[model samples]
Target: MIELSRRALVAGAAGATVTGLLATTMTSPAAAQDAATPAGPAASPIPGAYRYKVGEARVTAISDGVRTFPMPQGFVRNASGEAVNDALAAAFLPPDQISIPFTVLLIETGRRRLLVDTGNGPGQGPVGLLAPTLAAIGVAPESIDQVVISHFHGDHINGLLTAEGTPAFPNARVFVPEAEWSFWMDDGEASRAPDRLKGNFQNVRRVFKPLDGKVERYAWNKEIAPGLVSVGTPGHTPGHTSFELGSGADALFIQSDITNIPALFVANPSWQVMLDMDGVKAAEVRRRTYDRLVADRMNVAGYHFPFPGAAHLAREGEGYRYVPVMWNPVP
Candidate 1:
């Protein structure tokens, strides 16, 4: 059994509360400034990045950028677009646009450097900034000894290859979820999939073909790497997974795609996403998992969350709210 220390839980809760208040206060002022100064120099706000210590390990969150698009029909299979838009509006986001931010984490555990997931590769626009971001932190791609993937989604796997379609990390071992690999590699499954989803099936092959036998498949409940244990979290994909990163008395849950956009889905765990292969099961898992998170006061890192992506979940008026941690300028 895994346990969370009382001190960590209290700290996370306090951090979440402060963050929520700060975000609420800052958003209005920022938006007003943006509207009033349209012709001002477009200087970049300090990068969305942060670092925190989880026991002996040092975790850094790097931004790969964000992609915003109209909320696709059936985006939330169980809810109407109007309802989804309402939720987005409440979060001070545009009602019609869905923004997905890509965040990758670097875990330095004294002896080893581990990268959680690679972002969409170069040629996809600013998203390929992971490589440069890593460099900015003084860690080269070659310095990463291991790459642990939660699933085979394009945004997560595309960074495995460089813009030229070659291995991005020359000296890293890739670990993929066994169930995910099996589902994607099954020709029968692909043949049976709906026309709309066949592209994902094709993408899995394209990304892994060059690696050939180099990729290692890991099972749920196993430690794919030091201090990183894979937990079975399916429905988004056959082998979709979440990770439990623990050291001593500290822990963080790496929830990759468990909720596509927290404001919309996390606030309404019963809502289903079109990307969920099994919507009903996904909702069941989401509710149960989040119930536990709320009860345990756990800190989570969401892949599609705003940059840095680390947040503390809290029960809010029959749903939940994601309160992002403050950006610590010094990492």
Candidate 2:
């Protein structure tokens, strides 16, 4: 063997280190395969449905999915776009877009099943998932005993019919507020309705015309079903209504579109959504309803709230804060 210079010895060591790294990399077959292959498509979402109890009544919250779109210029009639963006940001929601969720409630007491406000009917983009969601939870449309509507809004009444424009709930007795029936079913009102609302008037006819002789009109302050009383909370529409369900000592307030996306209207009661037919009256109704809810410590279920939207209200600053009720895994 010949004596080596220090430079030659250093080069040999460096070469050895490179060889070791190469051998390690070559040995990792699994890693190489993982790096070579792209990830598979994401799994489908679980069926969106939840069940909980309100006293003896079993209430099921069925999600109709969400609609996300760029925020309209006049989304908030009373506030500027910049202010609306700020409010959205404060709620940890992304700016420049609005995501409105639709939730439908099904209350079962004794042998009767009453569905409150059908969601957007089938075939409407991300919406109209109510039928499938209900099916997933084993609730057949025919099993529904009564379908009590909160208002005449399309999202609230569209699901009354099927994709083929037939009654979805073939065996259910459909109930509409007397006031709502009077407003939307009036020929004078239909003729005089603004350009924007003309479509709503037409849609109301489309939905109710099929159930004409069969529709049952119920008045405010009446018991539409067992342990359920209708409460008129208008302004969002001329005849918008809410419901109070009481059993024993427990109660729940079904606030239907009283405040769309509580993150905005609930936090700022004075701010009005463009959907409000009477913006001023809607604001006033919102504040009044919220005050009573806070005072009574009532549990509330909202139609336009996120999935499984059940919460309690607390007065925060000038507005109110919605404290979501904890999810009960078992009913």
Question: In candidate 2, what are the lDDT values of residues 1-331, reduced to their tens digit?
Answer: 0001101000011112211111111111111112234323312132256666777887877777678899988999989998888988998999989998888889999999989999899888777877865653456888999999999999999999998889999999999999889999899999898999999999998998787667999999999899999999999998899999988788899999999988889999999999999999999999999899898988899987766778888999999997887643521
Model 2 earns a TM-score of 0.86
Off by over 4 Å in 1: 1-48
Model 2, residue 183: C-alpha shift (Å):
0.9
For model 2, the superposed segments whose C-alpha errors exceed 4 Å read 1-47
How displaced is residue 143 in candidate 2, in Å?
0.6
TM-score of 1: 0.85
- Give the top-scoring candidate (TM-score): 2
Query: What are the TM-scores, per candidate, against the unseen true structure?
Result: 0.85, 0.86
